[model samples]
Target chain A: MGLIPRTIHDIDTPAAVVDLDLVRRNIQALQTYLDGTPVHIRPHVKTHKTPQIALMQIAAGAPGVTSAKVGEAEAMVAGGVHDVLIANQVVGPAKISRLCALAQNARITVAVDDARNVQDLSAAAVAAGVTIGVVVEIEVGMKRCGVAAGAPAVTLAQTVAAAPGLDLVGLMGYEGHTVAIEDHAERAAAARGALGRVIETKALCEAAGLNIREVTGGGTNTFDITSKIDGWTELQCGTYATMDAGFRPHSGHMFESAFWILASVISRPATDRVVLDAGRKAVSFEPGGTPIIEDPSGLEIESLSEEHAKVSLTSQNPDLQPGQKVRITPWHGCTTFNLHDTVYVVQDDEVVDVWSIAGRGKFT
Target chain B: MGLIPRTIHDIDTPAAVVDLDLVRRNIQALQTYLDGTPVHIRPHVKTHKTPQIALMQIAAGAPGVTSAKVGEAEAMVAGGVHDVLIANQVVGPAKISRLCALAQNARITVAVDDARNVQDLSAAAVAAGVTIGVVVEIEVGMKRCGVAAGAPAVTLAQTVAAAPGLDLVGLMGYEGHTVAIEDHAERAAAARGALGRVIETKALCEAAGLNIREVTGGGTNTFDITSKIDGWTELQCGTYATMDAGFRPHSGHMFESAFWILASVISRPATDRVVLDAGRKAVSFEPGGTPIIEDPSGLEIESLSEEHAKVSLTSQNPDLQPGQKVRITPWHGCTTFNLHDTVYVVQDDEVVDVWSIAGRGKFT
Candidate 1:
């Protein structure tokens, strides 16, 4: 049997390729780390945005899944996944209505840091005659969302406790801002510092006699550090299952390279420079850079446009032909995955499955 | 009735807001600029990727439409667009098959810079029993794609002519590298210099007795400059309809603010800063910056994360509290539009229509 069922030329260039064995191994490793720990694994679905991946994670002992948008949660529920947490606040009537509707089938929880949002959630849940779980988001150094560590977070938790149609589930804080620190020691130190604040806030909530069933936070980069937090009931890591070039430097675990963009060199008119078929439209630009060329020794991707990538070779490699195929390991796999509609799941180089990112383009 | 619809709040937060009046005016202005010229208009659909917007451009006197992917062409065809140009090269079996299938129904044209691509196109066309229109892409200023300008381009044109199942329709070149120059006079001067090389290649092809009917190039930033080129026959401008924050400084015509991200302030623990509900997931970061705050009083967007946007407010505006709504104009409208599934079309305070970005997530 062929190691790769399809040759590089057989598949379309600029397509998102996922190594199935790597994804399975990543899941197994993460599960192994959390073994005998109280922390439940609730992997974030926002990374893959595919229900198939969510089911796989659940099968590997994940308690549930988390999504960034209500539309994504709804899609996951429709795909037969029962539990989902909209880890961000859902504002406006349209999104609130959708959230209420989603609660009819699945266990839906949302994070809120402000009291006004509590009112909105309560009203929406009351109108729908369904109770929605609300998690008080405490600021954990991201400085992006959530209330400050102590009194402010306690006030929000109190409001959630008093809200008629809302259930005060627990306290949640995301140390996302410190996840991708280039220095491994510094990243782990910052993760502990940030999660420590959330632990303090959880203590305050417990003192107020609040029922804190779950405390969730953590991303792919800080999953190892977050697993050691005393009060964190769940780790919400997403990008671990599909390792990217950007995460490799910060990740503490042995994450297999799972995602690659297959592209072909379309132009090689100059001796030093070449161009590929994939560019900003095919991949993403979050890391403010282009993908690393997997072949062509000493070549570096210099720049990218909407439909083409320019690669400059430092030394001559006779095997680097004009039409040769190469795989690009993107810097950020989550954003790159969001750019595509379908991903080919390959096991042992054969495309075992073609899964749709069904919840993609649900930004609203 | 209010000029701006009230349904804006009900539609969805972080939704794309397009000003129809502004879009119509932009189309009319571009059409007026090319009034007495022989150059035809073929707006690139990769920017909008919506059939409704493509139809509007065609109705505004565009000769045809252009796209970067076969999936985009297929979506446009389903939306009733007949003349479509896949302005990028299609490689590998899957994409070539789709490109050939698109040619079965529409007047399909594609860019070819490689001799092997010509053979691939010919094989696909012959297999489908269709004649695909081929354009010899010439490198002007953007080093990303296209064969080199003089004899190399002529050689590719000759190859296209010799191909049995392809027609040598025209030539295409994109000076995208120079489009973002902040200085107006310098931008026009740079565009003229680069396009001069492209025009020279066209002349060489003509002297060799090749039938070069249409010569297309230019994006929204350089539409006016490229339209004035003597040998250029068509303009492929796409971003004119929905001008982005980045293009505002370059565009001569004032297209009303069409797109905005409506985000609610979710946290305001500090008097100097506030966090918004919309973050990196809802916006495009390809421009390598945060969204421009629509408020005129100098509220700076500090930073962005996966689900939060930190805004720094002026000391004078300390009263800006949590739960208040704010509008954010993204740096790149094209990528932002692709991030969402449905965009609301509003008129006089109501949602007049909802258009699905059908070609979204078609990265393969």
Candidate 2:
């Protein structure tokens, strides 16, 4: 309805704005961290869900990109990504067929935990006449998905290798339980034990005559630790690119928060209380944590309604009035990005371009 | 991707399903309850956010649809809604101009708690050559957005009357503080006190020579109590059509949960644990509450990650395996509906139709 906004100030409130300079710096920082290291960065596209941003990560030294859903893989491939590793289980015939369709154009790999799921993928891939890559997801204390690390993982990988039109590509172990530990020493010990299981399981699979090429693992919190491990071929650090308030404590030393919801103070009901136009719809708080105000340091998010965020002044009240803009660092960048249709790419307060969050609502 | 799913089992996992028969029953129940009452229903579209559903509510008996944002109003008008009331403040020039533009198509009314916002609306309306309806929102126990009752509310009404290109439509008092009181008598007492404040303020505004009409209030939880209150012109009850688990505890006698996420069991790592494909991205938690498994009676949602819902066996394990469907009732329908692109309108296990949740991601 309006001209392409040339600056952040011109853009409307409750908009997802990503700093291109900061995003590039974030991409460069991960590349620098894994410079001489054997591990390569397979940036997770679920963070921004913008194929353009995923392509940016691939251009900066990443051999491929990581996706959590089949739709994301399709988007990444459509945006010109040749290689993609879906870090989660792609179950059901609908998604498996989608992956097979995508594999015809790009190198598509999915993590599998169950034998039936592997058989489903193999059948779909064979029917589509495309050889799909499969990674045995080893359980690393997350307890959400994946098979047990030792014999169970080897059995699943062997199934994938034996199935028609399927290639046993690699193994993946996500230490999701250790990613959020605040203490560095404690987190390092937890991640080492989890990754150690994956490394040992890879040896077991190799002994069983299964060829394991890529051993993918690691999140933003365990990137440094997993990179130090010997067998991890790709580090899947999602939140590192566009960091959030929850990951800032763990990854702030490496990357800065680039993704934020630019909201306008719509009401100043009390001296201590201010309401912004953005709320649970704009900024998420479940998976990651509570979002924090980055620009106005004095304001803290008290609570959020369906459409209004109630903020309170933690320090001295900053004479905020209605129509004043407030920059909020989302608690979880992935889910927050899922709420918006587009991300306004900004550089030093100037809106350079707009990229559609094409993977949003793609939870097919 | 596949043939338009003919049945619920043929539909993909992590899909939002709404039973249309239940929706029609809920709409009829609400209309029947207030058949002899003075107040008319102005259903809030924030729950479903579908213009189709909003139009359905209008067809049932609602005078107009209540929206929380300007973009929702636009979607409603596009869906054939002739009248809409945004029950929240419309601040800043960007949203003000949008409201002015929307006013030209539909009978648009917006709630205001500040003089500056009213001025902005007036200026934009004058520039756009549209007569925008303004309602002075009164703080009725909900400490989010609204002016104080009595004199302060009267003063704001007077300011709206004096503003050029604006019509002082009425007043709004949302008793959000008392909606979720578990006890009926206690909730009735609270709703009475809050509605009494709005009634007194309406009288005060009338004494100040302000022509006030259309005093709006009420939610799904407080609909019965708010309906009994005198002097309320419209009851803005949302979430009644497609109810959720969160409101079922209070409103179960009147409405059933029509909204749910049809997810597939992806993992069963333990004897007591079952993981579904739907998680935080597909179902919200903060604003609403945790989603519950409805069909499989023995399961209770333990926790949710970004893409998995971990459920625990409370009574006995149902022997759920991978690829089995589970119906999950979202804790809050409003926030959960915002997560999906389309809703599978089902009836008697058949996928009768698919409706787009048009107002989703329209948080501007």
Candidate 3:
């Protein structure tokens, strides 16, 4: 009656919708890119917490899944993923014990930057009667975690090898600072430079007489750049499955926007201004900007509250009214993914499937 | 022994914790302030979605709860809060149907800015054989929703009164723009000026043969200011129960911060730099600021990424290390509250209870 959705007429507003075709295309494109490469693609499950999607990625070509937290790894296993790698550091006994228990049903791997955390994880795995794979994380550019390159990383690898129930597998290095560069040439150069350091650290690990098996790193931002680089056994890319608006300004591979927020206009106060029901809680405003409405020039975004986004009309060609459904490309895919509980997988105008955000808020 | 919490020490990192004592104190203090006023206090449940805290507010003198979405209203009703007022616009037939259903079980009321929405709501309520209270939302200073001041609001009120199964309860005017003023006198004067516009709108509605039962307005930022204003029968203060750092710079009421994020340091990469396992997903980067580390000079927060917070130590006296627990006072309470699933209610050093964030992400 008022430009309402013909197929998704009954579903609630402020819902996350995934275009199935776009998602498949994205997954297939990335797989096609890595088809002949020596590196494997281990998709990070943080972007889409659904095990169904994880299974889909695995069926496509993923060897295993990457997790950010132990709870997320547990949820992924619960969702049917068996081999999981927690790419972030796992500290303390509680989380380590949980990780060991998860290893009972699946092959578990974790990253380590601290020797004490390595010892703790090894002890927990030994008590649980399981062996856990360990990866020494080397700091390239992102100063958040991981040991410094060279001697420090070598020492951490030695610690992992000495610990019982823990097998030193490889090293991980995240080039987070260089991944978001807008310039294609600059970003590629920066990625290669940062990854050069990671490669040096891998050489250091090899020199230390550790039989390194796998090397994992990279994100959706540096997916293409790292794919061309040698020595990384597996690349962890999460946001490629559902590209965000933040990547548009710096996309080298040109992944299509696969995920969008479907929201209904709930209030139209003036002819010039209308308010949508999706805001910070429903849609995330991260990676430095607000989302782009499906038609970029249609509505002007005024401000966003916790539960509302106010937009002013810039043109009158397609006048917006209350009850009209619109789509928005999220600014950051991972942050947007964490905000929702379920995602409606759509094909054409109708909802084809619904997937629970199995790992949403699994912030252990 | 290796930094493993025996009890809650195992309950992952970066969790929201609420002090029940502070909740009670904030509720009592607000009630005491409203005790002398002519207006009633209806604590908005948006701050703390837990039914236990809402029940606490009710026990402390709240008549009902103000919800931003229908899902929150449903959760409050499920938690035994019978009288609920959704202080935002409720649009669409599907949402209106849900509102009608909730109305049958409880005394449900809503705010309206558009006449068509009022008609839709009225039709749905009539079909459901339940009466719904309608409040014409008046556009105060911060205009996200609601009709323009005098005649526009009067027309919406007339529409509500003329529609079957609808009662024109009162008006809702949110002074969001003036609520965050730093100076007490300026904030109070601005709130009074905004409330005066709402009062004039109420009078206009009355002159048009519509009855005004209640006039609700104000937020935690301007609770005291609006309480002293004339013609406001009820004040809706959401953030008073759990104070935030945004109010600290310009607090008119100085409500003690009850809500905090308990995080574990997972990485201490450098002597000067440490990383806490809380970030935008754990603690929201809203209202344009980072969270205040419980002790101001202990650790200086550098930045918050998707799942990690990089902090630099300011003082070496209280040495910060990995796996040490620290509390953070979030900059904005409402946005931060929507990011978690559970809130650990701690009294002292130990967690006494756990409250499910029932209304978190209830963006209908």
* lDDT per residue as tens, model 2, B1-364: 4678999989998999999899999999999999888988999999999988887888888989999999889988988999999999888777887888898888999999998888888888999999988888988877888898989899889999999999999999898899999999999999999889889999898888899888998999999889888788899999999998888889747898898999999877666677888988898876446788998777788898888899876445688888899999998888889999989999998999999898997888
| Clashing residue pairs, backbone N/CA/C < 3 A, model 1 | B5-B349, B6-B349, B17-B258
RMSD of each: 3.3, 1.5, 2.7
- Report candidate 2's interface RMSD in Å: 1.8
lDDT of 1 by residue, A244-340 (tens): 8887767765787788888887777567777787887677767545577765446667887766788876566544655578888887777778778
TM-scores of the models, in the order given: 0.93, 0.98, 0.96
- Residue range B233-263, candidate 3, lDDT tens digits: 8988888888888875665555798898888
DockQ leader:
3
Candidate 2 regions with alpha-carbon error over 4 angstroms: A313-315, B313-315
**Which one wins by lDDT: 1 or 3?**
3
Q: In model 3 chain A, where is the ten-residue run with the lowest total lDDT?
A: A1-10
Model 1 DockQ (Cα-based) = 0.51
- Best-first order by lDDT: 2, 3, 1
Q: i-RMS values of the candidates, in order? A: 2.4, 1.8, 1.3
lDDT of 2: 0.88
- DockQ leaderboard ranking: 3, 2, 1
